[model samples]
Target chain A: MFKAIITVKLRPSILDPEGKAIEHALQSLDYTALSCVRIGKRIELQVDLDDRAAAEAAVDEACRKLLANTVMEDYTFELQKA
Target chain B: MSKVKFGVVVFPGSNCDHDAYHAVKHVLGSQAEFLWHKEGDIGGADVIILPGGFSYGDYLRCGAISRFSPIMKEVVSHAQRGGHVIGICNGFQILSESGLLPGALLRNQSLNFVCRHVHLRVENATTAFTNQYASGQVIEIPVAHGEGNFYTDLDTLAEIEDNGLVAFRYAERDGTITDEANPNGSLNNIAGIINREGNVLGMMPHPERVVEQLLGSDDGIGVFASLINAISGDVTIPGVAVLP
Candidate 1:
């Protein structure tokens, strides 16, 4: 078995309205030190693959298929034997 | 001959209804009107459009709340019957949320509100909305949104491509289609897509903004024109002649 960690984020050019709203809310609350805040999703998967290559392939396929949207986000995964 | 009546859905916060209306009316010279979000029927309109803007204040996610609105119920039914539906920006989010389209629009990776013009390639011009453009044609349109990331499963992505549902792709800085030019990081640089029936279209860019030459380039007019041609039974674009 192997474990995989997947991180997904939007591309730099696309706007993040949720983050802006949070920034405004923070300023209204007088938390001025917060310069920036970006939000993303992290997913971890455990698979029963025997080989590292197979595990990596599964992770990549997962990211490409659902975990990440190539249009607005990028995903990177790290695998470790369980 | 009866004029093709088009209706643009107006949600509470929709700021692009007028833009969409004008694009259909002034640019395509079609009869277009605005339909309130609460309206149950789309007035037998041949084409229905969901314009961009923050709906329900982006509550419960960008389009999650709007998906349940009364107008959407009708829109869903209409689209299921093979009526043409075009969702732009926030409309795209709403379509995905309503399950009329695949994938979801998540927050941008940078957590910024990106607003700019982007070049896109006409990857599949065979849909009712994209029939006026040539395959591989590059056009520029304005993009302004926070959550425009498109996501789907691997098999679904391959299936969409294999079925020729991918309508548009991002163009690189060199004006060529490539993965690197993908602005939103969408899978396969997918900028737009249509339903299996070739009637529904969802895209992030505002083609309405580019329909008039006075606004800049008129590349977007072709999208509007394509629909006009589709309903008129005069679609003649060689690239869009066959379903991919």
Candidate 2:
């Protein structure tokens, strides 16, 4: 079995409104040194595959097809044997 | 002339499906039906309306998981066949996710769910969906959503403008495009856009919700009338008359 860890984030060019709100909140709390803050999601999945390469391929496909919207977001994944 | 058949796709979380159906069946006096999301066929609809609301509970992202619904395959094929398709609000997000539309909707710059009436200037009235409205006309439509800020690559944005694909732009009551008139900070104040082929439109406004004067404004009736006229070639725009 393999476990795949995926991270999805809005592209740098796209504006992150929620992140901006968080940044404002942090500033209010006196954490004023931080210049920027962007938010994203981390998804973990378990794949019952024999080979690491096969598991990686499956995870990549899942990300491309569903987990990530390539139009405004980017995704990266790492697979480890379980 | 035959009545234009409208199929309102009912995704699991779609709240506007009934509104769309009512607008077509009652307000517009046309044939309308509900198409469940799991069905693989379009049921011979001349126009397919992907109504608003969070589909699949907006999992992953707005309209991402719902794009994989079985009905979406048929919707894509229908769009490829040059049939008419309109995605309103969340439906717009689904169309972008399914690659039917050019851009994606992002969270509003204010990070708040905005719900109110806004003016939209008709940018391209020559298309199948805007023929009933005069060019440069400002119409009032209600928009309700958080993820309505439209975004695209700069190259695609240039192409969309060069091709005149923008159908409507957020504007002042007098039809001036300005940042203050923009409800969601969409690029170029875009409120609606048509596909290159001019048959598919994805917009953030709920035209179906305002088709009757009783609801607030009948400005949205033009959109349905335009579609009906495009399909059946004979629809008279409803108007106020001094009761004989």
Residue B91 in model 2: shift from native, Å? 1.0
**lDDT tens string, model 2, A25-70?**
9999999898579899999989999988888888888888889988
Give the number of the best model, judged by TM-score. Answer: 2
Give per-residue CA lDDT, model 1, range B1-244, as digits (tens).
2277899999999999998888777766678889999998999898899999998898646876787789888999999898889999999998887778887776554556779998988888777888778887788888898777677777788889899999988786455767657666677778889888888899999998987667877778778778877888653332222322
lDDT of 1 at B213: 63
The weakest ten consecutive residues by lDDT in model 1 chain B span: B235-244
List per-candidate RMSD values in Å: 11.2, 2.3
TM-score of 1: 0.72
Compared with the real two-chain complex, what DockQ does model 2 have?
Answer: 0.85
